[model samples]
Target: MRRMRTWCERFLRKRSSRAWFLTESNRIACVKRMGLEAAGAMSRSPSAKRHTSSVSLKILVDMDGVLCDFEAYLLEQFRSKFPDEPFIPVSERNTFYAHEQYGSIKVELKRNITDIMSSPGFFASLRPISNAVTCMHWMRDIPDVSVWICTSPINKYRNCVSEKYQWVEKHLGFEWTKRVIMCKDKTLIKGDYLIDDRPMIHGEEQFKPNFGKHVVFTQPYNCNVTTEWRLSLWPERKDKLLDFIMFLREGLAFRD
Candidate 1:
C-alpha cells in the first residue's frame, strides 16, 4: 500500500505538471490542507507505512500593501502635514503634470521619515489592511507554505526594515519562521510567489521567472493597473485581496 500510494502521487504530480507545462513538486495546497491527518494515520495505524510526501505551498509575500497598509499610512501623514493642500488624485497625475501643478502635490519627505521614526504611536496605530490577517492565516495553515517577506529597503532609510519587523511581530504575535529580506531586487531572490505593489521593481520578468504569479496590491498612487493579477485595498473594490490569492492558487503553478 505504501509503495502504491507513492506511485499514485507521483503519477498525479506528473500528470498535473504535463497538463500545465509546470514543474513537478509537492507544493499542492490542497494535499497539505486535506491529506496530512490521513497520511499520518496510515503511517501509524499498524497498517503499512504510507509513503505520502507532505505538500507545502511556498509563498513570497510583499510587505507593504499585501501584508500591511503602508500607503494609507503615508497618505494620512501627508494629509496631516498639509491639510490645506488641494487633493490631487493619483489618477489626475497626468493632468497635474501637463498643467505643471506639481506645487499642489504632497510628497513624503525626509522630515516625514523622521516623524515616522520618532513617533511610536504613529507606527503603532497602523493596522493591517482588511484581508491582511486572512492572508497570513492561509499561508500559516499550509504545512509546507513558507512566507518570505520581500520589501524594497529605502537606501537612505536603514531603520525602515527594523520598524516594519517590529510591527509585523506586534501584529503576528510571533516571530516569523521564514526570514524577511530587505532587498532592492526582490525578484533576484527565489520564491514561488511575490506580493508587491511596485511593478517597476518586481514586475520585470527577469527577476520572477520561476514565480507562479506576481500579486500587486492596489493603491491610488499605483494608478497604472495591470490585469494579469492585482487587488485593490479599497473596502468596496471589485476584487478582494483573498480573491486574487485564491485565483493564483487555483490557476498557477511554478515551473523550471
Candidate 2:
C-alpha cells in the first residue's frame, strides 16, 4: 500500500507539470497572435465581442449587389450618356451585356467614378438598391450576429477603399469598425452565408465545405451564376431580403 501511494503521487506530479507547461505555451501563442510585440497593440477583443463584430457573422454581405446597387448606378450613367440607346432601368437590364453595345458606357462610368468618388455628391448619386439599406439596418439589430461587407475593388480603383467607407457612412448612417473587406479571397474569412453577385467567387458545388450557402444577387452582367437562389432586387422579390435577415436573426437567436 505504501509503494502504490508513492507511485500515484509521482504520476500526478508529472501530469500536473505537463498540464501547466501546455497552458503557458498556449498563453504565449495567443499573445503573439494578438500582436503583443507591436507597439500600442491592445489585447485581442474577447471571443464574444469578435463574434458580434462586423467581421464575424452568421450572414456576410457582398458590397456591390447585396448592399450597394452598383449595377443600378452604372445603368443610370449609361442612360444619361446614351439617352437614345434604349437603355433600360437597372432592374430591367438583362445579362446579355456585350462590349460592342456597352463598351463606351463602361468607359464613361470608369472615368466618372474616378472623378466623383472624392466629391461631396458621390453618395447622392450612389443610389443603393431599394431595400438593401433597410435589410442591413434590420440585420444590425440581431443579437451576436455579424454583417461584414466583402468586396473586390479593382486594383486600378484604389480610391474605392476610402470611397467605400464614405459610401457606408453616408448610406448606413454609421461607421463600421472592421466590417469592410476588399479582397478576392473572401472564403478565407469565416462566414455562415455569403450574399454576393459572383457565383465563381465561392467555389464548386459538390466540393463545398461546411462554410454556408452562397446567395447570388442577379445583375445584367452576372446572370450565368451556377447557384439557384438569385435575386434581381429584394424589393422586386417581395421582401426576400427581409426574409433572409429574419431567418438569420432567428437562427442566431436560438443558438447555444
Candidate 3:
C-alpha cells in the first residue's frame, strides 16, 4: 500500500506540472482575448474567468493504437497459435473484432475477440509504430505541454496493467513510466486533448466532445471517425503533431 501511495504522489506531481504549463498557455490566450485594458489591468469580467476555467490543457496520448502497432502484434500471435489456419493479411484487419475477420476463413482457428491479451508478454511485446518514439520526445520537449499516456487496461488480464508499464519503460524509455496512466475509463479523465483511435459513441449516437479537443489517432478500426486531426502513418504523423502543437502555441498569441 505504501508503494501505491508513493506512485500516486509522483503521478500527481508530474501531471500537475504539465497542467500548470497548459493553464499558462490558456492564460496567454485569455490575455489576448481581453486586449481591453482598463487601468493597466484587463477588466475583471465573468467571461474571462469562465474561459480560463474551461480549458485544462493536458495532452492525453493513447498506447495501443497511437504509439504501438497492437493489431499487427495480435495477428502475429494468431498465426503462431494456429499455424494450420490461413494467415489473415494485415490489410484485412479493418475492425476491432479479430475473430470476425480471421475466424474460420479456411481452417478455423476460432480465437475469441479478446484472446492472448492476458497471455504473458503480450502488452510488453507490441512493436512501436514508426516515428512514435521521435514524436513522443518532441511532444515532451514542447513548452509547458504535459504529455501523458492514458491507456485502457484489459480487466481480465491483471498482467496487462504491469506489462504496459514495463513496455513503456522498455521502448519509450524510463521517463515515460512516470507519465503512463493505466485506465479503462478515459471519459473520467480531464484533459485539453486526447489522441486516441477509440470511437466516441454513446449507444447509437455520437459521444459529445466534453473531452476538450478530440484528436482522433487513425487506425483501421477508427478510420470511420471524422475529424480534422485524423493522423495517418508515421513521419507524416510526427510532422503533423509538431505542426499542430506549434499552431496552437502561436495561434493563441493572436486569437481573439
Candidate 4:
C-alpha cells in the first residue's frame, strides 16, 4: 500500500506538468490504471477491506439533463437543422418532453424535433452542464456514497444507446461507462437518491414506487414540481445536497 501511494503521488506530479499533451482517452486510461493499482493494493490490506464494507449509500444520478446539457443541445440542433421552423425556446418549455411542447404547432415541427433527437451523434455531442462533472466526482469521492448514472435511452435506441455510452466515456471517463444503467423503468432500480429532471417517471400502465427518494434536478420544464429535495444549481448547492443524503443515511441507520 505504501509503495502504491508513493508511486501514485509521483505519477500525479509527472502527469500534472504534461496533462495538456495527453489525449482524453490516454489521460483517462492513466488515471484508471493508477486507481485500479491502488485499489488492488488496498484490497490486500485488512483495514481497507473493512472500510470498503462500510460503504452503503447509493446515489443514482440521471444523465441527460442532470449531467449533460441535453435540452440545450437539442434546441441548438433543431434550430440549425430547420432554420425557419417555429420552435419553443428552452425557457418557454413547460413539459419534460420537448416534442410535447410542440404538439399544438405544425406536425412537421414535431417530426423535425424527433428527427434531431434520433440523429446519430446528437447524444454524444452534448456539452456537460457547468460544474456537473466536478460535482459528480465530488459525490463519488464521498466515503459512503456510491454514485451511478441511471439514464433512460430514447425509444429510437440505435443511435441513442451507443452515443450515451460514448458520451459518458468522453466526459466522465471510461470507468464511469460501466456504471451507466440504460433502463426505461427507473422506479425498479434501487438507490438512496435519484436526481432527475423528469416531473413524472412511470413504468408500464401506472407510476411505480421508487425505492429511493426522487430529488428533482431543476430545469425550466420541471419548475412546477413540488419536491422537498431539489438541486437547482450544481456545486453551489452541493453542500446542502450532501447534507440531505447524509441525513437520510443517518435516518436509515436509526431506523435499523
Candidate 5:
C-alpha cells in the first residue's frame, strides 16, 4: 500500500496524471493498467463483485390473478347468491374493489365477501386458471430457476392463510406447499420477477418495487395500467413467462 501511495505521489508531478486522478473512474482504470496486483487488491475490497455461477435466478408468482382465479371465483359466488341482481359483466368493471357497483345491496355483498374470505374452503375451492397448472409444472423442473408461489392473504381473516396452503397442496401438489410465502408487502421480498395483476400494489409513491421486472397479469381491474408485458390469456402468457426466464438465464450465463 505504501509503495502504491509513493508511486501515486510521483505521478502527481505529471500534469496529465494529476488531471486523470481527479476523476475517480479514470484513476481506477490507470491503477489496473499499472499492474494486476494493485487491481487484485482493489477487487478484493467492498466494491468487489460477489455474484457467483452457483447463484440461481428466482421467479416469484402471485397466487390470485396469476394462477388461481380468485376474482372469478368470488364473482361466481356473488352471482349465485343474488340471482335477481341486475347483471354487470366483469368487463364493465374498472377495478377489482368495485363493490360500489352492487348498489343499495352492498352491505349484504360486503358481509358475504368477508364471510367467504374467512371461510376454510373459499381459497381451496378456487379453480386453477387455464394453462396455469401446466406452466407451473414446467417451471418446477426448469434449470437454474427457483420458483415460489408468493401470495398475500387477507390478514384480517384468520382462515385466509391456511386456506391458501390447502389450495396450493391440493392443486399444485404437496411439493409446492413448501414455497408459499404470505406477506402483504411484496417489496420486502427480493426476486428476479414478480408476475401479478396489480402493478403499483398500494401506491407507486408509497410502496415502490424493491427490485426486478414486474409482469402485470391481465385483469379487468388492472386494464388501465398500460405496459408492454400485459398478458391477457393463459397459453400466450405461459410462453411469454418461459421466454422471459430464458432471457434472464442467458444474461446470467454470459460475461464481458
Candidate 6:
C-alpha cells in the first residue's frame, strides 16, 4: 500500500508539472484526460469555424469617416469656433489623425480640435457622406449579409459614447443603434470584412490578429495606402463592393 501511494504521488507530481508547463501537446493530453475532445475544447474560439455557404457574410462598417463626413464637419466646426486659427483643408490632409495635421501648425491647435470632437452633439450634428445612408440601407437589405457598425469612441468617452449612439440612431435609424459596437480594440471583433478609413485600426505597437480582410475606405488621409479592396465612391462604386462581397462568399464556399 505504501509503495502504491508513492507511485500515485509521483504520477500526480508529473501530471502537475505537465499542466504547469501548458504546452500545446500537454494541453491536448490534459483535455483528453478530462474527457473533453481536444477539438471541442476550442469550439467557441473566434477563428474556430470559417463561414460556410449557409453562414451569413459578416461585414463591419466604420462610422465616422465611412458613414459620415467626419473631417468636413470637424473643419467646419473648427473654422466656426476658431475663425482665425489656421486649418488644413480636407483635400490637403495626409496623416490618419486630424490633430496630427494641426500639431505642425500650432501645438495648442490639437487641443482645440480635440475640444470640438469631444463636445456634445458633435457626432450627431455631422452630415452623412454622399450616398452613405443610401448605401448602408442597400447593404442591410442584401441577402445573407450581416452589416454591423464597428466604431471606437474617443478617449473623452463622457460625451463621445452617448453621442455616437445618438448619431447612429439619427442617421442609420433606431434599429442600427443596436448594431453599434463601441470597441477600443477592433482586432477582437470577428468579421469577414472591415470597411474603415484608417490605414491601421489597432495602431503600431499592438499586433492586430484580426480574421477580417480590411477594406480601406478611400479618404484624403489614407490615399497613400494601396489596397485591392479600396472603396472610393459610395453607390457609384458600389458595384465593386458587391463584387468583393461575392468573391469572398465564393472563396469561402469553395474552401468549405
Evaluate candidate 3 by giving its C-alpha RMSD to the native, one decimal.
13.0
Assess each prediction's global lDDT (C-alpha) against the native: 0.51, 0.52, 0.62, 0.71, 0.63, 0.70
Compose the digit string of candidate 5's lDDT tens values, residues 1-256.
Answer: 4555444455444423112123344344434434554334333431121222233778788988789987778778767866765545667766655455554345566666566556667788899998888788777766667888888887565777888898888888998899987787787777876778775665232355653666677878777876544456454344444534443442321100
- Give the 10-residue window scoring lowest on summed lDDT in candidate 5: 45-54
Q: After best superposition, candidate 5 residue 44: deviation in angstroms?
A: 34
- Higher-scoring candidate on lDDT, 3 or 5: 5
Q: RMSD per prediction, one decimal?
A: 10.0, 16.3, 13.0, 13.0, 13.2, 15.7
lDDT by residue for model 2 (36-116), tens: 222012122222232343433467777766677666676666566557655545655444332333435565544554443
Model 3 regions lying over 4 Å from their true place: 1-56, 99-113, 201-210, 236-240, 248-256
Worst 10 residues of 6 by lDDT: 44-53
- Which pairs of residues collide in candidate 1? 56-144
Q: Report the Cα lDDT for candidate 4.
A: 0.71
Total backbone clashes of candidate 5, pairs 3 or more residues apart or in separate chains: 0
Better model by TM-score, 2 or 6?
6
Candidate 4 or 2, higher TM-score: 4
> Candidate 5, residue 234: CA error in Å?
3.2
Q: How far in Å is the alpha carbon of 171 misplaced in model 1?
A: 0.3
Off by over 4 Å in 5: 1-55, 98-108, 203-208, 236-241, 248-256
Q: Please give the RMSD of candidate 1 to the true structure.
A: 10.0
Can you rank all candidates by lDDT, best first?
4, 6, 5, 3, 2, 1
lDDT of 6 by residue, 1-256 (tens): 3433343244335432212122344333333433233223223221222222344788899988999899999999999999998989999998888998898899999999999999988988889998888778877866778999999889888988888898888887899988988888888888887889988777432365363777788899888876555667564445434534544553321010
Quote the lDDT for 94 in model 5: 64
Candidate 3, position 251, lDDT: 31
Once model 5 is optimally superposed onto the true structure by TM-score, how far is the C-alpha of residue 94 displaced, in angstroms? 1.7
Q: What does the lDDT read for residue 250 in candidate 3? A: 31
